[model samples]
Every structure is written in C-alpha cells, then in structure tokens.
Target: MNAGLNDLQAMHLRRLLEGGLPLDARPYRRLAEQVGASEAQVLEQIQRWQDEGLFRRVGLVLKHRALGFRANAMLVLDIPDAQVDEVGRRLGQAAGVNLCYQRPRRLPQWPYNLFCMVHGREREQVCQLIAALLAANGLDEVPHQLLFSTRAFKQCGGRYAPPPAKEVANG
Candidate 1:
C-alpha cells in the first residue's frame, strides 16, 4: 500500500495474484495490461510491497503426481538438538531432497526434530535415494523413518488478500 499504488490498482493486482500469475511467457506484461500500468511499474510496486514485509516470498507449488512422480516420502530424523542445525543444512543442500526443515520434538510419542521430503517414480527408488542421502551426510546410524504418502493432497501457495466486497442492491 505505497503512495505509488492507488487503492483500485492494488485491489486488482491482489485479486489477480490470488489465482496465481498468468501462464504466459510475459506474465508481467499481462499483469501490467490488466492494471493499466507499465510492466516496470507493476514489478517495482511488487518489490516495494515485499520490502515493506507484505509478503516474504513467492514460490512455486509443483504438481508432482502430474509430473509422474508417484512416490513421495517424508524422511523424519531424530537428530540431537546440538547437531540438528548442521544436519538440516547438509541435507537441505543434498540432491533428491525436495524440502528440508526442523520442528520441535513432541516427546513421549514423536521424537523427530528434523524432516526432509524425497520424491521418485517408485517407492523403492525413493528409499534408495533416502539411503544414499543419509549415507552421504554421515547419518547412517541416525534414528529415522520414511513415511511414504498414501494419498495425494491439494497443494497451493498462500493467499493473503480478502475477496472483493459484494455490491448492495439499489433501493
């Protein structure tokens, strides 16, 4: 909401973003056309918003199943608190690791503090890849589990802007 952007333009841009960027070679140009502004202006406004902390990032949500990646697994590890950060960084950079993150260990039942995702065309392939990742990271003896996804779930990016207000009927 900078001075450079009017309320109407901001609303229009947010509504368009809610559905995701247009699938075109020049998506920015398309967005500029919709907002009646130059592509550079639109990009500059987006950068300003980002700098003001309106949104931290914009990223892709891949449809792995559609790409023929049938096997997906969450590899959870029970790394010691002291070494969790180091281990997580190493695994995050390794191949075959789609995503990596750390979470609090829910003791007495769940003890995993680190998690990474691996995907492949088959369960066996995923398992082998996970094994290689662990071995390469020198975590051969770490306590872990490979929880393969049993079903595909909908995936999408974050939506921040609210829907447009409904127009009232005239008396």
Candidate 2:
C-alpha cells in the first residue's frame, strides 16, 4: 500500500502478513485462502510487485540472539568504489556474514560504503573472523569499524495501512 499497491490489494496482503504465513508446504496457498485469492494469483501479484521494485526482500527474520549467536557486530568498511561490490559479494558469501550491502558514502563525516553483519557465540570470535576476512581478502589497508551491539532492541515486522481510495484519486 505504500507505493505500487492499491488500497484493497495492500489490505489483503497485510491481512495475510499480520497473521504470519503458515509453515506448511502450501503456505502461499494458505495465504491466498486467507486473503481471498487463489495461490497462483497471490504468487503472480507478489512477483509483479517485486518486478516493479516495490520492496527489496520478503522473507523470514530470525532471532539470532535467541539461537545462541549472541554477538552481533555490524562491520562497516571504507572500501574503494572499485572494490565495494566485490567485497560486498565476498562478505555476503562468507560463513557467518549474513547481511552485506553497499550504501552511499557520507562525506566529511562518514565514509563507509560496504557494510556486513557477523554473528558468533562470542564477541572475540566475531572479531577474529573479521580479521581473518580482512587478511584473506587483502583489505587490511582499508579503514573499517566493528560496532558490536550492546543490547537487543525491539524487533517486529513493518506495519502499514493503505490510504483511502478517494485520497488516491484526489491526490
């Protein structure tokens, strides 16, 4: 409903999402049932939304801290423009480096562009792995920061509601 979706369509999607997907093999089918559509209809709409760049991702979010991977470190690298994509790919592919991406650099204050999240049972282990990754990738000369989260924050799925149809037409 935030962008490409109309009010009714987004409402249906939100209705299904708010209840969370069923764990069965036919989860989409179940979603369709709850949202008043067929399985294929739901799939096609979701695919169309994705193709239109409505959202970057749609998937499950795990609670790593509850799973014993307590140490969560966000590693930001000041990688050169030429190396950012390559380094981000490598980091994303590496074990324990779950999240990796390249963001715009903020000049005169922050210069980091490549970012990754590494998790481990212990903080020291996470640090050691980062060192290993830097050495292995020959990124020792690159400036970086490893910011370990001191506490867990409230985590939840995004919430949204579609605007009235009249507003959509008038605006």
Candidate 3:
C-alpha cells in the first residue's frame, strides 16, 4: 500500500487544497506563512505532490455555467462492461465533453457505468453533439440519459480537508 501523509504534511495539504488558496501575487509566501513553512518549502512540496498522484489538479475552480453557458448536461451511458474502457476514452475525446468518468453500474434500474458532462451555448447545440456521439460510436440504441440542469445549485471542487478519524477503543 502507498504510504499515507504525516500529520504536518497532511495539515498543510488540507489547508492549501481545501481552504482557498491565497489570493495574492505572492500567494505561495502567504500560504507558507499560514502553514508554518517557508515559501520555497511550500512550492517544493506542491511540486512533489504533483509528481505523486496525490493531486491531478491544483488550481482555481471557475464558474463556467454562470459565465453565459446556457446548456449543460450530465450524460450517463449504459455501455457494455467489456467496451467501457474504449467508450470512456472516446467519450472523453468528444467535443464539449469536459469530464468523463466510469462509475459502478447499479443493475436492472440503473444501468449506466459511464458519466460525462457536456457544456455548450445552447440546448440544441448540446443535443446535436450528443447525437453526433451516438452516431459516431454506433451506439444509437444504447441506453442513456441526458440530464439537463434546470437549476445549478453548486458547482465546485471537492473538499480536500482530511476527515477526522473515528476514535477506537481497545479491550
């Protein structure tokens, strides 16, 4: 198993990743001070974390939907188990498909294993892209759903703060 983070490092990562990044020209300096580390040390540690798979991204979360994007849909695909990998890659490459991921299939009722997001200027445009994906992949008959957003409540990054471990008692 991969080694877990130590206390200080975990705390620093939690603050830096979950808590908002310092909004300054010398943000690293401010962040280091807050985390009780030197500026150079913070930068180095962030670079190291990037090298490791601890983080795929460390940046600002912009509000794309609020920025005049009229169409946004969460598309779930019920692809065959064997073809999931291939279809996921193709869906990821599809135009306007900003995000694509594989999820566990819930049998009978919930059959979708692939989920992706599509954003566009208009509903028609988004539908057209989805149609293109269906035709291009010869998956017109594949079970799927396009969940268009009626009201976007919250679109933000995941919370990176480490959850407090449960207390354990020994007999």
Candidate 4:
C-alpha cells in the first residue's frame, strides 16, 4: 500500500515475500518471475521499501525446540533503576543470552525490571551460562527468577494487510 504501488502488484509482492524467497542461486530472479517483475526491479523495490522505513531488518525466525534446544528460560532481574541501563548492556552483550531488555517494575508486587532469555539443549547448560553471565556482569547477588518454557507452540510470521478498498457504484 505504499504510494505509487498498484493494488495487484502490492498483493503479489506481499504474497511472494511473506513465504520467503525460494532457495535458488538467483532468488531475486525467481521472485521476479513469480511477481511478474524484473529481477533488478524486485531488488530495487525492496531496497526502496527499506529506505522508506516500511521495512525493518530482514531476519530469520528459528524454532528452538525443533533444533534440539529443549530447554528455554526467561530470566528476570530486579535491577536498580540507576544501574539498569549498564546492567542491561552487559546482559545483552553476554554470549549465552539470546535476548536482553529492560522493563518497568510493577510496584506492590512484581519488583523485577530487567529480562533476558537463554536457550540450550539442557537446563544445566543454560544454568551454567547464566551463572557465568551473572558472575561476569557482577550481578551474582541481584534478585532474579527463571521462568522455564513448559509447552510447545506454533510459530509463524505476522500477517499484514492494507485497508479494504472503498466500494463505488458504476453508473
């Protein structure tokens, strides 16, 4: 729905891109064929979309359980407000942590603020990594809790759509 892109072309582009590029030497060429566009045009359009801020970084989403990473835990730390940023940076940079972030504490109950996720084939391995990370980051004494994954869930990319076209009577 970006300006200047036709409805049909936009739908085709979305349909093709959502499923991901085909595994081929010339994926752009294949995409172009599927979308009825030149390979260079396809690439150029994508770059244009990115430049226009309509796109974030293109990345892969992996299924940890399928990859044998059966153990996963989300660690929440009660970091002081003054030190949260520095601690978060250290946690984010640590090797074992897949994701690190800071969030506000829910007062009167939940005191934890910072969070990070660690995944491994074994819970012990994850625990070891977390221990090393904590000792290295000087957060060994920080109040923290670990929430483990208890069930499997389906995974898929989000779907997006433009507003529906307005209906008009043809006289």
| Candidate 4 lDDT over residue span 38-103, tens digit each | 777777788878999977767666788899998999999999899999989988988888889988
Ranking by TM-score: 1, 3, 4, 2
Report how far residue 106 has shifted in candidate 1, in Å.
1.7
TM-score of 3: 0.82
As for candidate 1, its clashing pairs are: none
- Give the distance in Å from residue 1's predicted Cα in candidate 2 to where it truly belongs: 27
Q: What is the TM-score of each predicted model, taking all chains together?
A: 0.83, 0.73, 0.82, 0.76
Write candidate 2's Cα lDDT for 7-109 as tens digits.
Answer: 5765777656644678989998887776667777777777886899975777777788899988899999999898788788888998878889999999979
RMSD of each: 3.0, 5.9, 5.4, 4.4
State the lDDT of candidate 1 residue by residue for 1-171, as single tens digits.
Answer: 324657788788888876789999999889989988778878888887899998766877889999999899999999999999999999999988989999999987999999999989999999999988888888989999999998986777766777878899999
Task: State the number of backbone clashes in model 2.
Answer: 0
Q: State the weakest 10-residue window (summed lDDT) of model 1.
A: 1-10
The candidate that wins on lDDT is 1
Q: Itemize residue pairs with steric clashes in candidate 4.
A: none
Tens digits of per-residue lDDT, candidate 3, 91-152, equal 89987789999999878889999999988889999999999988998989998999998887
Off by over 4 Å in 4: 1-8, 11-19, 54-56, 157-171
